[model samples]
Target: MNRKTLVLSAVIGLLAPVLAGCGDSDGGSDGGDAIVVGTTDQYAATKDAPAPLDPAAAYDIGTWNILRQTVQTLMQIPRGGGAPVPEAASKCGFTDRENQSYRCTLREGLQFANGDPITAEDVKYSIQRTQDIKAASGVYALMGNVDALETNGDSEIIFHLKSSDATFPYKLSTPVAGIVSSKLYPKNKVRDGFEIDGSGPYTFKADVKDDTIVQATFTRNPNYKGDRNIQNDKVELRSFKDSDSMGKALDSADIDVMTRAMSPQQVQKMLRSPKDGIQLTELPGLEIRFLGFDTDAPAAKEKAVRQAVAYTIDRGDLISKVYDGMAEPLYSIIPSNVATHTNSFFNKYGDRDLAKAESTLSDASINTPVKLTLHYTSDHYGAGTQKEFETLRDQLNSSGLFDVSIKGEEWKNFRPNQIDGDYEVYGMGWFPDFPDPENYIVPFLDADNTLNSPYTNNTLRGQLIPQSRREADRSAATKTFGKIQDIVADDVPVLPLWQGKTYVASHDDIAGVEWAVNSSAELSLWELRRGSSAPAA
Candidate 1:
C-alpha cells in the first residue's frame, strides 16, 4: 500500500471565478476586497450528507475541519478552551434532579441558510441520525450513552442517558451532535446536492465543481438569536490541487488564506520571510499520533517484541523533523494539555534507547532477522508523514532490532486496513471530542475499541469507561482515567509519538484568526475582516 491522494482541481477552478465576489451576493466581490481562503481540497457537497457534511464517513481530520467551519452546532468551544458555550442553544444543562436527563433551550427563530427554521425537531433529527447511520458514522460510539431524546414545547430538548454520564453535555458540544433543519433533511436518509441548509455564520453561495467554494455577505441572521464567535460578513474558500500551488497562489494574491497541507519546512521558511505576509496561528491540539502494533500478529504478539520496538523510537527527533517544532513530544496517546496524560511511557522508554531495544529483543530470544511492515495514509496528515514513517523504519532496521517494510494507502482505504488489523503495524491519530480526560482514555483504550485491535489492559475498557462516565463529580472521574493511563503505559499497546500544534496560513488581508481544540479546527468566519488589500510585509 502507498499513500492515497485525492486532488480536486477542477472543482476549485469552477469555484474560483467568484473568489473575489465575497460581497456581491450575486457571486462577484463588491466588498472592495474578498477574503480568499485557501485549503488543500475544494468543497464538494455530496447528496444525503448530514448537517456538518463529511465526505468520507470515516471522520478524516480535513473533512472535520471543513465541517466545523462550514456548519453551526448546538454548542462550541471558544478560543483558549475551557467550558463550551452555547452556539445554537441559549443555555444547555441538566433539568432533572438526578442529572441523568440533559436539556438545552433553543434560540428563538433561528433559521438554516436555506430558510428552514432550526427547531428542536432538527436537533432530534441530527442526534437520531447518527444512530440511524451507525455503520457509516464514525461518531456512533460517542452517542452510545444516549438512551432517549425528546423535545418539549418546541423550545427545550431533553436527553436521557443510559447512565449518569457526566460528560454527556461535552459530547453535545461536538459537531457530530450538530443540529440541522429537519425541513430540508430526511429523517432517515441524507439528502444529496451541492447546496447547504446550515445555520452557520457564513452561507454557502457556490461550489464551482472544483476550483473554489464561494460565500457572500453575511446577513445578520434575524433568528441567529444566539452566541457566535465571529465578526466577518463573508468568506470564500479557494482550493488548490496541492500545497505548492496554494503557496504560490497566496504569494501571487490569488488567495487570501492558506489553511492546511503546507510542509513544515515551508512553514519555517514562511515564518522567516517577513515579506511573505503569511500569518501562522499555532495552538496546542488535543490530537496525539501513535503507532498501533498488531498484537494479533505472531511477530508482534510478545510483550518483549512490542516493548523493544517502542524503545527504538526517537520521539523528539521525529517531532522536530516531521512537525518543525510545531508539535510537542508525546509519551502517551493522550497529549499533555489533556487531563489524564501520564509520562510512564516516557520514563519507561526514555529517549530512543537503542541499547534497551536490543536487550529486550535478545532477552525474548528475538533477533535481527525480524521483519514487519508498517503503514500510513498518503494525504491525511502533514506533508512529511511518509518521510516520518521512513525514518522510523530505518531507525528500527539500524538498531538491528528488526527489518521493517513500509507501505501506505489513501485515507479511504487506510482506515479499513487499520481497523481490520491487516498490517503488522500502523500509525493512527486521535483528536478529542471534548477537552475532557475521559475522552482521551475511553475511545481508543476501551476493550472493544472501535478498531477491535487488541491491547493488553482490557480492564481500562471494561471497567474504567463505565466508572468514569457514572461519576457525578468530574474531578473524581479523573482518578479513573489516570489509573487507565498508568496501566496503558505499562502495557505498551501503542508507541506514543507527538502532539501537534494546529497552524493556519492566511493571506495578510484576513484578520481575527483563531484556533480551536478540536483537531478538526473551526474557522470563526464571522470574526474575520478583510482589508482593502494584502498587508505590506
Candidate 2:
C-alpha cells in the first residue's frame, strides 16, 4: 500500500496458485477475458494534491497498485514470499559490510513502455523525485536512509545510506523504487496529468473523469523485461463508489475480482453464507488501523490528554462494534503477527479504564471533557470507515472524558489536511512496503515519520532503530523493538487500535486468484487468468 492507504498494506505469504482445472499459466486463452477488478479505492490529483500516477509523489495502496503494474522496481518480493530478488536489476546487493552502500546492475536491454531506455540514471531520478516532492502521502519518508545516489555509467546505480541498514534492500523492493523514464519526469516538479513510463510487467492506461481515476486498464507490455510471469495479456481494474456496487458488479459478471473494501460486515457475511460461483479468498496481511495525533494541536499537544484518550479507548468494544470480529484488538503499533509484538498499551493502561483516563488528566491539571476533532476519509477504506469513526467517537464520548466529534473527507483532501495538522487527531492506516519489524515501527517513529506527529525519541530513532537495522535476522531485534513499543505506549503519540485482515473476492473461474496479492499486499495483476468456464451460478 502507498501512503495514508499507503491506504492499507502489502501482500505476502500466498496460497498455492488455484488449481481448478487451470490451463497454461501464462497468457491464458490469449487474454480474451480482460478480467475486471472492482474496489471503492479512490485517489484525486487536485492542484494542491500530489500527482495521481507519478511514482515521485504517489504513496498510497491505490496508486501503488497502478505503479506495481506499470513500473518495475530493481528488487521484488517473490510471489510465494521470500527474500526479494532482482526485477529491473540483473543483480542487486549491499556492496559493503556496514550495509551502508548498495548497488544494482540494470538488466540488459531494459526499455520503458514508451520506448525510453531504463538506465541507472533513471533509477536515480525516480528515487530522487520521491524524496524531493515529499507529497502529502509522504513517499519520501520511506527513503530517509539514503544519503546520496551515484551512477556508474548507464548500467549501474549505487545508494549510500546514512546508517548500516540491512533492511535497505527491502526498501529498494517497494513501489517507491519503481524506475521511471528520467527523460520524461522532471527533476524537481511533480509530473502533472495521467502519464507514466516504466519497464514493469504491464503497460497501464487510465480513464480519468473530473481528476479522478475512473478506470485503469493494464495491458501486457510486449516491451517489458522483468521477473513477473505475464499470465494475462490484459487486465482491467474498475473503481466503484462503495462495496455494495462492487459486490453487485461481481454478481452481475461485470467485475471478475474485487478487493480493497474495508467492510468487515460484508466479509463476515460472505464467509458465513458462501456466494455460489464467487470464491472469497483471504490473504495473510498486516494492515493496521490506528489514531494518529497531531502533536502540535491544541488538546492533543499535551501528553496527558493523549494518554487519557489512549486509556479511554476500549479496543475490544471498538473492534466488536465496528469490525464485527473480523479484526482483533491490537495493543501495540506492531501487531501480534509480527515478531516482538507486546501489549505495551494494554500493559500500561489496561484497556478502557475510565478512572485511569480521569486521573491522567487530573494529574496534569487539565479540565474534564477534552474536546477533540477526529478525522478520516469517507471512501478510501470502504463504506464502514465512517461507521468505525462514529462508533469510536460515541464510545469515547460515553466515557465522559472526551467530547469527540468527527470530520470525514476524501483521501486527496484529507491527506493534505492531516499532514498540515488540520485535525487534532486523525485516523490513519499502514500497509507495509516490506515484510519486516522495521516496516512496522520505523515509519511512524523515525524523524520525518509519516504520521505527521512531532513526537520523537533519540533512544528509539537514533539508537534502537539504527541498531535494529544492522541485524540480518529480524527476530534478533526483538528487545530493540520491544523498547520502541514501550516508548510508544509511554508517549501515546498514536493510539493503537486494530489490525485488519485482507480478502479478495473473485469468480471461481479465475485460476490465479490465490496468488494475486503478494505478502506486502501488492496486487500482481499479471497472475489472474480465466479458466475453462465458470461454475453454474
Candidate 3:
C-alpha cells in the first residue's frame, strides 16, 4: 500500500469544496487565528488526563492526538496519507537489509519549545523510557523488538532489533514513539501533571477543569521546527457528554468542529436534514466493532460454544437495525478495503443458521440455553450501544440455544476489567494505529497483544506474523494473512461483526474538514481553519 496517497474516496464530495477553498485567495489568513473543536466527553483531556504529557505513559488515542500536536516523532504520517516521512529527524531509514538495524539523523540545531537542545541522546532516552517505565497501558509492544539503542553523536541514533520487522518505520510514526527532552524528564521516573516541553507544532498551555469535565487549550509553538503549518494560533478542545449535545454545540456554533463518537443515527439525521450552518464530512470506514470471547471462561472455553454464538449472530439485522446501513458486515479482522481481507467467517458460517448452531452444540455434548453475559461500554462506543447489545442479546436468546444477558460499563472501568478478563464475552471496537493488515492481525493474536484474552495459537502468532513482517513486498505476504484469517475463523476467539464509517461535523465555514481525518481515522486538529467568509462570533 502506498501510505502517502490520500484515501478519501468515500468523501470526495465533502472534500472537493474544502480543498478548493484552501487555495481561494479570498479565504482568510490561512486559518491561523483561533478555532474551537468539540469532542465527546470520553475524549476530553480532563476525563482521562495523562499527567506531565509523558509520551511513554500516554496510550489512549485521545491523549495521543494531543501529543501528536506537541511532540515530534522520528517520522509522521502526513495529513492526507502516504509513507511515514521524517519529522524531527533530517532523515531515517533501515541501515541493514535484514530490517534489524534502524538509524536516524536529527536535524541540526533542533530545540524544544523551551529552547533546550534536542539531540540523539533525547531520542534514545525517549524510546528507552517506554521500556523502563513498564506502565500497564503504555505502548512498549511497538518497541519490543529493540535489542539495543546506540547513539553515534548529537545528531545520529541507531536501533538494533531482536527480530527483523519491516513495519518498524510505521511504528515510529505513532505518537507512542514521540521523542522527549532528556533534560526535562527524569531518567528513572515518569513526570506527573500537565507540564510538557517538546519540539512540535503546538505547545501545552492549560488544562481547564470543571468538576468531571476538562477542556485542553494549546497555542502554536513558535520555536518548533517541523513541516505542519499551524492553521490556528490557538486551539480549544471541548468535550460533550453525548452526540446530541455535541450536535447542539456544532449547530449553535459553540464549537467549531466535532470528531468521533457520533452514532450512525446522529450522523444520518444530520445528513438527511443538515442543520442550517453545519457541515458533515463522512470518511472511509476503517473501524471495526466485534465480540471478543475470553477463551479461558468456562462457557467460552469450548470451541463449539463459541462457534454456536458466531453462527447465531445476525450481522445483516445488526447492520440494518442497529447501524441503519452506515456499516457493512465484516467477516474478517481486517477491514474490507484493506489488502489480504477475506470473508472467512462468512464463508464458514453462511448466514445465521440456528439449526446448524444447534447441531454443533449437540455434537459437542454441550447443554442448550448456554448462559453468557455480553459487556460493552455505554459512553465510549457512542449512542445505540445499549440498543446494539440488546439486539445481539435478542438474536442469541431467540435461537433458543442460548440465554444472554447484557451489561454496560463506563469506559474508564470497562477497559481495565476487559483487559483483566472480567467478562465472558464482550463488545470491543478498534481504530487502526496505522493502515496495515498487520495492525489488525498482530494486536489481536500476538502473545502479548492489546486484547488480554486467553486465546493463543503458536503457528499464527509465532510464525505467520513474523514471516509476513519480514516480507518487504506486501503483496507477497497475502498468503500468510489468508492463512491467519482461516485459523481465526476456526478458533472463534473473537467474532468479527461490522466495520463503521467515520463522520466529522463542523461549522459550515470550517475549511479543512476534508483534511481533518487522516487515513488512520485520527482527527488532525492542526488542519482546521475558519474560512475567510465564515461569520464572526
Candidate 1 weakest lDDT stretch, 10 residues: 12-21
Model 3 ranges with Cα > 4 A deviation: 1-33, 41-53, 206-213, 532-537
Q: What is the overall TM-score of model 2 with all chains considered together?
A: 0.92
In model 2, how large is the Cα lDDT of residue 351? 80
List candidate 2 segments past 4 Å from native: 1-32, 532-537
10 residues in a row with least lDDT, candidate 2: 1-10
Candidate 1's residue-wise lDDT over 57-158, tens digit each?
325554455555546777877654556678888888876656689888888877776677777877887888776766343566777778999989777888
Best candidate per TM-score, number? 2
lDDT of 3 by residue, 1-537 (tens): 001123443221011111322231221112235688877745322323344257776665666777888888888876666567888988999988899999999888888998888889889999998888755553677788888999998999999999888888888988768888877877767676666678887887655564333577778887788777667677877777888888777666677777767878777787677565556666667789899999999989999999999899999998888888578899999888777888999999978999999999999999999999999998877787899999999999999999999999987778778888889999988877776688888778886677767799989977998998887667778899999999999999889999987777666567666776654457666777666443221
Q: Tens digit of lDDT per residue, candidate 2, span 481-503?
A: 88989999999888889887677
